[model samples]
Target chain A: MKKLSILILILSSAFAYAQTPEEKGLEIAIEADKRDQGFADSSSKMTMTLKNANGDESIRKMRSKTLEVQGDGDKGLTIFDQPADVKGTAFLSFTHVLDADDQWLYLPALKRVKRISSKNKSGPFMGSEFAFEDLSSREVEKFSYLYLKDEAVDGEDAFVIEVRPNYKYSGYTRSVVWISKEKYQPLKIDYYDRKKSLLKTMTVSGYQQYLGQYWRPDVMVMANHQTKKETRLDFADYKFKMGLSERDFNKSSLKRAR
Target chain B: MISKMIKTAVSCALLFGFSQVKAGEWSGYVAAEYRGFTQSKLDAEQFDKSSLSLSFEPEFYHSWNGGDDSFTFVPFARWDEHDPQRSHVDIRELVWLHVAQDWELRVGIDKVFWGVTESQHLVDIINQTDLVENLDGEQKLGQAMLSLSLIKDWGVLDLYVLPGFRERTLPGKDGRFRSIPEVDDHTVYESGAKDKHMDYALRWGQTFDDWDVGISHFYGTSREPRIIPTVTPAGLRLVPYYDIINQTGLDVQATFDEWLWKVEVIHRSGQGETFNAFTGGFEYTFVGVMDTAADFGVIAEYLYDDRGSDPAVAFDNDIFVGGRLAMNDAASSELLFGIISDVNNRTRFYNIEASRRFGDSWVLSLEGRFISAGSMGGPFSSIRKDDVIQLELARHF
Candidate 1:
């Protein structure tokens, strides 16, 4: 009888060692988040192209600077440089973990800094297929993950995970992401609507290593299945560790963001 | 090598007193506008209801000292088909800015706007109004000043020393939108130095959580001129009288969820009598309504002024309600409509403005204004026939 009890204990210990899919998913997310850290600050220029169902296209040019805030989310400033009507327009944001972000908009025509509401998550950004929430910094705590399975995406081994937004304001019910197994970077994401129907698909490509450690995507294209519209973001040269500080992200400095 | 010599040359030029500065970039827009009035001109001396105008605003910018110091210049001009007074030119901005670790210094002619309410700007007294540009009073001529701003964790305190003032632009007798009795270009000032009288202002602003507050005081010549009707040598004309005044203002804005609340209050002494005026409003926005990719915002504000006895200033007590629609599309189209109605009388004003980007470098804008010309017989009596629909197409570079 004593030998039988020892065998049962051994079996129970083995079962405990095997993690559930949720736990495994969270472990992968933590690893991915860890790899993206230590980039003190970054600056980049990007162009956004929008295409309608009829294949009509429009382009936007902008420059962005981001500063990493220790123990919290990042601070970002974006200045619009093209589409002449919006030239010199600037936007400033301070993202906080588990708290609402602070946003400010600077309009060249008004020549003033105005505090804006950050709760408009479902709204499109710059008339693009990307929603406002999609452009915000993605913290590990913002979503809950569930490991679906392992799949090969475009002949590359990747892990498929389903993630549901933890925030209440997100327009997406859930999203399915394909994370490259080797690089721990996202290769594609499928967003679902409130009715649990697929709404948009985003594919990322052209990964470039920056700072000898950081992996950044050169292009990300988001397509809306419902409207048959698409928006493509083409990133230009990205400079990391630009020595940016808190003073550069303040509202008063928005007028000089360029 | 060549690069090292060029770097040394740049450093030497910087060491000297800017003997050679880098060439600045130029950018601006040229707009052509057409205005069609709904009614005929009110007076025999007025011009035709159909009007055409062309406007240009060019900007030049240069930066140095690792971007800590910079200079900006913008010049604006307009050419009217009719009314010579409407054809004008002014310096919009020509300023040099220096930024230090905690403080910033700005000198030269600059355009500064200070107000929170949407119905009217009760505390925005930094620049003179370019009245001839439009009756909506959204344009201003630059004022020369030296400003110092101390930025601290607690708040931002700004001090200004204004040395020169630009006279308010008035409409000519032939102008379509004009108050009866043509205004005399000559002006009388209570100050001994006239337009050169020095002005001083200071403002302290801070943000707490979701609220932003600003308190300011200005002791200078009032931007609004008192139009005193008198029989001049030419005829019965309105003479503009400038007065030195002391004004204090407070503005606050609170942002919560999808709602924005704003209020601006001011107390002025030296115009005619000491009085207090206030304007407050709120805006609530709905995003992604009706399964469409558009955002709609509803706004309402109350305007109050105890100086109703003054005939020159209207909208003493009014309620303004408005709506804004932003179509989230590739064209980036937007529309704004508002109505301001006097509480004491039947005076009401309706305004509509819409704009959309055409391509990479072009935009189209439309504006329309309608007035009821109610019991308020001040400026409304003259502008009753000035209801106009304006369209502008601009090409930017």
Candidate 2:
């Protein structure tokens, strides 16, 4: 009887460890999402530095504003301020979890607002290494997750997750992300192209707490392996919950974005 | 006269003390251009085979009253060595704007654009065409206006009270674009009030997830004048007659992924008859072509007018095909090639434009235009013998 009980115990333990990787990954993603709720709105200024393989560099200044939405993806606006040729240019986006994002660009020279095709979301953002899709708010439902394993990054425990986009037009086939265990924030991400080759790697650092509840990263660096190009974004002046609404993000507001 | 206008503009800028205003911004550009006609001077009619020109445009902006009120002024001037008519000065924009929670008001000389078609801008008529500047009809002269805009969740409504009319600038006798002799500057008006007559316009524009639409109506003097040949003491000249007219226009665009579909239509009752015209087109883009960061786009547009061959402009039945190439490089390099072909006849017009930045503040541009033999006797007859290439270098500050 004791021997039979020991066999049964071993069988039950094996069964408990047999959960699918997909299920485990999804649970971790949901947990991260739950921890990042209730950030109503935020505005920040950023400086972007772009460098080529030859080490040539150019700098750009911009201001960004974002509004967090319930049951939907976020709304964002980025207005360019430096570089005489691109000054007064603005980009506005309305993102969705399961649908293509809507975007518009206001050109100062033409004094007109042009709608950007949704398929262009995968294109480069303002000649930088960061694609438009990468700049957008990452909604949990946009991708299907598969938990890879638990790892330590820079002496901090993190959950390594692999996610495949559910949308058809995404430029990436899959992305592997490392989320810090303590903050549930992405510490690093590796992007794979449609051919399943590693394309780029992004590292997030300089994290600071805002309003005592929300954490924001101050520096983000994206490097493209194929082109040997790099883009570094430094964010400053973060203000949250300043009474922004939907009306502030509409098309007409593009003209007043300055 | 040009120097006087410049002095007045400078005095106004100083009187307002705009430079002293905190947070005010000033920007401008200066450009030099050289044009060489592919055709001989004799074949090009009265136009010079080679010419040089310089131009400058400066703008200033200031905000006060806690950012609720703002002021802007832009003065533009150009000088050409070969064509006197091409050298002129004008105020591009001088406006005082006041913003509220959901509405805004603007009063001054401003420029407005309304259209969706790349081949032709049928609905864009608020500003007079600066014909001497470019054959593409993209350059515009500012007009004095009182505009009020109301913004809402559904869309935006804009009402305009255009108080004065600016006559279109015509090419000089030595200019390359003139189809006929020089147009007389003393413009004739059908209305007794002439240039003083007030014009009004209203437009409502809205955008959805994948669609952008606009509807507009204008009841006022027609910007395109009917040219009447008349003998004057100086010589035989073309007299421009501006007529009163009413026009309704619609523009729509649908964007789906890499494809964009656009349509623009207009119905007008004026001059001698009522007519309808439309332009519809589509643009498809291939991004990251061949695994590079370059983008290539193909565009096709069809233009039609009810007047057919009898129309003054000769766009009765036409098709336009164009290709745009963007390198997506750091210098913002781009090239555009297009051909406008008349389906009813063998007339065809081809143009190419390419530009790239040299450094942080300088840009270089190249342009060329050609016309086929069938273009004779049409609107392009004036330039039947003229094929030209141009180069320009500009510096921004």
Mind giving the per-residue lDDT tens digits that candidate 1 earns over B137-220? 879887777899898998888899998667888888888767887778878898999977999999888889899899999999
Badly placed stretches (over 4 Å) of model 2 are: A1-19, B1-23, B42-45, B233-235, B373-375
Please estimate how well model 2 matches the true structure, expressed as its whole-model Cα lDDT: 0.85
**For residues B57-90, could you state the per-residue lDDT of candidate 2 as single tens digits?**
8888888886677888888889998788899988
The lDDT leader among the candidates is 1
The residue ranges of model 1 lying beyond 4 angstroms of the native Cα positions read A1-18, B1-20, B233-235
Question: How high is the lDDT of residue A79 in model 2?
Answer: 95
Worst 10 residues of 2 chain A by lDDT: A109-118
Residue B147 Cα positional deviation in candidate 2, in Å, after optimal superposition:
0.6
Scored against the native two-chain complex, candidate 1 gets a DockQ of: 0.69
Report chain B TM per candidate. 0.94, 0.93
